[model samples]
Target chain A: MENRKIPDNKIKIPIIPVFDPIEELNMYTSLGSLHTFIKGSKIISPGIPFYSIIYLISGQLEASIVSRTGEEKYLFEICKNCIGVAINPNDDHEFQITAVKDCIVYFFTLDMMVEILSQDANLLKKFILNIVQKVHYFEHQARDLYQCRSSSRVFSFLYDLCLTKGKRVNDHYELAVENISQKMIAKITGTHPVTVCKLFTYLSREGIIKKNKKVIKIYDLNKLCNLIADEELTY
Target chain B: MENRKIPDNKIKIPIIPVFDPIEELNMYTSLGSLHTFIKGSKIISPGIPFYSIIYLISGQLEASIVSRTGEEKYLFEICKNCIGVAINPNDDHEFQITAVKDCIVYFFTLDMMVEILSQDANLLKKFILNIVQKVHYFEHQARDLYQCRSSSRVFSFLYDLCLTKGKRVNDHYELAVENISQKMIAKITGTHPVTVCKLFTYLSREGIIKKNKKVIKIYDLNKLCNLIADEELTY
Candidate 1:
């Protein structure tokens, strides 16, 4: 593949293509449109009325949910084989801008996503399954945050990412947390920035992970799994 | 509404004529058939290849998530306006038979739900919004678990619940934890049963809450909210 010239407004975000699991384009032939977002772009403005589900091919996106009290941030980070279904039209929430990199996302409007799903049971099942899976992940994250202490929480997060997206090769599992910042992780972990830093430092010191500025390389899969299972807080 | 002598199985969960600020049937209209389960009934068998979401209207439900290592139990006790969306079909995690009260749930296959949402963009949006709201609640719970030390977590939970669902008349807000057991709350709070019991006893002695079996009737709204906002633990 040739290096495509980047769009003037956007930096090209890393996108991994799948040859085997390609979705049938003929499925939702009507109700959706393919949309690309430049880095630090706005897809939907707060207080505006729109409804769509977004599938991320490559890039990072954050949603700011505005409430009467204040604004809350929700990160719809990169996920393979998953799509987000935004169902409310008149419901307005706050969304602030913060983009790590440029990205491409497919937008399936409510009417179109619904029409396609209704017409095709298999596709509908797939969509529902995707939402369910995401919900499961969210639930698991919530549980981890609730049950585990700060030290073990980090291990649990890493272990979970590995389990979902890790690739095993030569006894090590390589994982990816694309466009995810340490501050974002701190919010997700429900801990202070210092706490997250200390946890990362401790893990790196133990040689369990090879930390390279942003990317994390796991050295031992078995040890990582062990750490996740051990709730005694070995670190 | 008159109390009609509907057969035990024939009885449908009572639908609220109107649900809060938003009054619409789009959320619950998809419920074609009503499923009534006696207390302790198993909605989904473990390892069974079934894809259905159970929307609870009344009573308590305990879903045990089974993994290769062990099982974890989650309590879903529904009051009015509280719905449960089970998303276990995403992976191999099966829901084991735990416990359920006289629960009335509307069970819909994945295809069915998608079909409904496809036809009605408004409904789909409502569904997504509903789920997002639930996610927000869980996230708040997780945050409380992380930031607060002990009894404060409990107060925060109560305070948030009141703010979301409480009925305010005059100055006091009527907060009800309906049809849920204290043990179930302990699970939600991630605390020991004895600790919850002790906290409840202290609160009752202090006249903060009037306790009935299977119910905790909060009497003072300001105090509860203040305790929740306070930097120090109240109990």
Candidate 2:
């Protein structure tokens, strides 16, 4: 391989403000194309020669992978201005992406993406931040899903929510839970609704977590983390 | 937030050949400082207000995080020319990096690293590939670790190896396993070495995996994947 002659770019890297993927998409319009999908259409599936990255400009997408038993394992959702899928051609893992609502998407071939990103520092920074954030998210999900105990799994999920979404308030973490509920938590963790309620009480009585009208607070993160290893916790 | 003005660098993006991190590190010498740590010294520790990305230029380091019970969970090792730690200032998680051998390392404040990377498309691409590869590895690990059965955990480990290192033949995946052993498999999966050997025989008899003197072959990836959900397989 020939030596890569990199010229020194003396420009100061500016503080990146809020990200706007749509704005970035406009710059490379000549190199890529925009496509639309109606609701209930498959956007991406396994073994389809996928190597490009598609960014959602509008609507929503549900990305999943079929497990060995042929069950769809929900990976994530792609909302407006977010990445729909980024696949390396050499990777062995396969996933399916479907449109949950009518969507407008932009496709950038991997080569073109690399070209544009390598040329523009700000664009590369936004892309890196986006992927790094996803890495952080999957890390948290893996930790929670790896819990052996069922009830502890739910607690791990809450702990993840606190670490990712809750803010440190004085001595502990506090999160406004106005948008999340027990039923939603159950659906995610596969625990029964009754069991999720019981485990919440268990954590509340144990001083690990406190639940109020529209907020959930963590008094001891370490204690909640420890409960993730327990076989079971009785309320 | 204002719209970013991106210039047209008519220079075609060159094909990225083999990565040379040391070459990349040399270009950014002014942006970072190099330091040496003797064996047994801690490079990163929890609660030390860490926010930098260190590149290992020499020797080895072990990275770990203390679980809630104060036991160390081994994360990964840092060899030469690899990132020892990349901590974002806003992230709440903490980890400890320790020198297993006397090491020379380069420190780049997260800001400086980002600055340098954004300025060089080639450097940024390498960094993205590195992090994305880590994401792939951890996802494989999470899948294997999520398997509840002990024997199946070992199978999951093999399945991971197959997916990562094995090459596809006519219909099966074949891996040269001269380096891995039953003892290593048992240590990783927390199963007995005897159990590991027995499980190998069970999988072989079941027509899922075939182990030879220096190689392991998988006839059916789906069958092996399905076995990860099993309660147990007796040889």
Candidate 3:
């Protein structure tokens, strides 16, 4: 792929911005307020005034959108160094963010961030790139959901989780999903709880995965990827 | 909604950026190049080097992503004042943009844009907000595709079109979806081509919409919105 020649006039931009958490903390400390929440605490909720860009300094969080009729759609999980934006300040917030574990978050007011960004063009570009990267990520995830079936959706979600947050231990990879319930997983995968339970049982029986408490261990990463591949082809 | 008071600490930001075509043209003129394409011409293609931010100055275009196996997925339609981003510089572009009508587009190199943005923070904020808006739009569209049936999806698409681009004529709204065929509509709605044809015929017969050549006139916008409402309830 590197050997291919691109046209000289065609310019390239970074799809996503890279941020060091420690550096981000030092930069924004003077302008923002730091807040800490214990596990299972709501960080932002619907109908609340939310205008700041919430930066996850450490720990994990889950963000979701709730419809007017109370149907909750799980959006995505936020790991460290991720930024979350609420599009409007006046409208009722259709989304909520909650800490899945004890977390350190920084609330940078939009005005202050704008004030600071007005002087630093490079930082602003990085900010824009971060948002663009998120847009691409959501677009891809939505496409997968629309095209793949229930089983494949579950498998794909697991495969992505392993790739992003998995820790390698010898030949296996382990992920601490931590407090994410079967129902939440079902919501994320667009599958039913029963279906998720069934799939897990099947995988366990096949010795492909072992779930002990909040952690899931994948014995063979290649096997799981192959399953997703087969599912995609079959669909 | 306006009666509600937000907390003092909460500072609002615009949900979407506002850009004037004339203003954008002037800004990019010295920094980038202007290009024009005839209807049906390809602006971006797969395996081609594409790196700059493409801004639509006038006219319309359709962008789609093609899989390695040649399966094409219609992504979105680009209208005036919209910005298109090619996410990665090194990877083969999975998407292509084609002119739906004779279009004037501006190409801004990433480096040039970065250099200019580094001097202006408000413009940078607007740029970031624009990408975030696109992200939210795609997310909503994907949700509709995932949750709604084929017929509902088609209706929802039409309803949204009328709301956004529809021009008022007498008591009705008309949308000039010129050059957009039933097949394209099917791709956008995630329905079969035959299904789109059947729905159009049914809608025409029911007097909700009147189709003459490539133009569609919505005689009863309320009825169309109601149809989508009913579909949601039934589903």
Candidate 4:
């Protein structure tokens, strides 16, 4: 929510490191391949056979999993400067990633990553820490989704979105990324589209948030924060 | 439940690599320390100011976190050859690890891990992969915990435990480690102690599993599997 003064450090933004300047430059020169995708393009399809690191240079990507029943579940968004690694070679490409906007991504095969690691130990260590931190964040997200109520889930999702991708504009916060739809919000919060719609209506009625098509503007940031705080106690 | 024939490759056992033969040898010689903890001893305490990788050499260790309400929640168990890395230097040590039995653990600091990576490129890659794999596993675990009911949670917990630390016996699968308690099971499954007790009673009455003090032997593994399958569809 953008209307209140939110502390910057409260948000946990994942960082991708360029550990060794010389080694990184050389690795990019030798092994990295740049790929561009148009908005709404599928970057990774299920059942494709490849394992590598996808470093988002610009734009946004959404990762989702399609279940056996053809139900799609949204995982998380990979914003610019973030790295997504596929560690298991045997994995069946269960995760499908699509470009949320026109994007440029750097691809590095597992072998190439290993080669880079060989040259830069600091890079390897940072890579390991990156995954560890991601695990921790996902664990918390899981806990919130499973343990908290639907309203709390929606609030927490918005809070996290603000933390990671929101920009301060005058007295309000605006999300840096665009085209966040109600369906996308529903998927990320693990709620039904109808439920998300209802919650937004309630928030709007209460003067907590205002929705304009795909854009959600928070008018009372502290109110949303207090809602989360109250939800935490009950859950 | 280990009585049924389980395909060997069906289990996903995480493997930690000893990266460089010479550097690994030098690492042990330079900084490796072996520590032994008796049963029930605290291997890691809350608020401790240190970060290291603990490699389980022998015996079992249980990692738990105390909630704000002072309830101890069992996270997971560490068995032999598994490496546990503490990546955050500023962490308040919210996780407390205790030995479930007399245990031998190898300790290496973050600095030493970086040193090891500096010497061995392959090890660094494996380390990064290890954490990535862990992130994936924890993500699944979080999904199960959040999406599944208490019974499915308990069943999945046992299923995962069997996969990771189970050993083949004559007719049944047995856990390699010992001293798994009901309270611990309740904590890990995110259910009430009474609920876990009730589930075990139901399983025992239905001739699916038999519980001895702390060890549980499943007589009909298929039944448990079926329960999971049924639960999955509903959840």
Q: For this target, which candidate reaches the highest TM-score against the unseen true structure?
A: 3
Estimate the TM-score of every prediction: 0.65, 0.66, 0.75, 0.72
Task: Give the clashing residue pairs of candidate 1, or none.
Answer: A31-A112, A64-A94, A66-A94, A87-B125, A88-B125, A114-B118, B39-B100, B39-B101, B40-B100
Instruction: List each candidate's DockQ score.
Output: 0.20, 0.15, 0.34, 0.31
Could you give candidate 4's per-residue lDDT for residues A1-235 as a string of tens digits? 5543122112232322111112233346347888899999987776664467888778888776655334566667777677777443444546678997999888887667777766665566556656666665554555555456788777767876776666666676666334567776776667778887887787788888766864667767888777764644321
What does candidate 2's lDDT look like per residue over A1-235, in tens digits? 1332111111111111112343676667678778999999987766564656788878887766554556454456677777743554533345688998999988887557777776776666567656655544444444444434567768777887887778999998998878567865764554667988889888888888888869998999998888877765556
Write the residue-wise lDDT of candidate 3 on B1-235 in tens digits: 4453344222222212122222443565567788999999998888776778878878887877675456677677777877777645645656688998999988887667767666665565556556666666555555655566677778877887788878999989988878566787787666778888988887888899998777899999888877765644321
**Model 1 score (lDDT):** 0.55
Candidate 2 per-residue lDDT, tens place, B1-235, comes to 1232111111111111112243576667667888999999997776565656788888887766554445454455677787743454433355678997999988987557767876776676567666655554444444444435576777777887787789999989998878566765664454667888888888888888777879998999998888777765556
Colliding pairs, model 2 = none
Q: Candidate 3, TM-score vs. the true structure?
A: 0.75
Root-mean-square deviation per candidate: 9.5, 9.4, 6.1, 7.5
All candidates' chain B TM-scores are: 0.61, 0.62, 0.72, 0.68
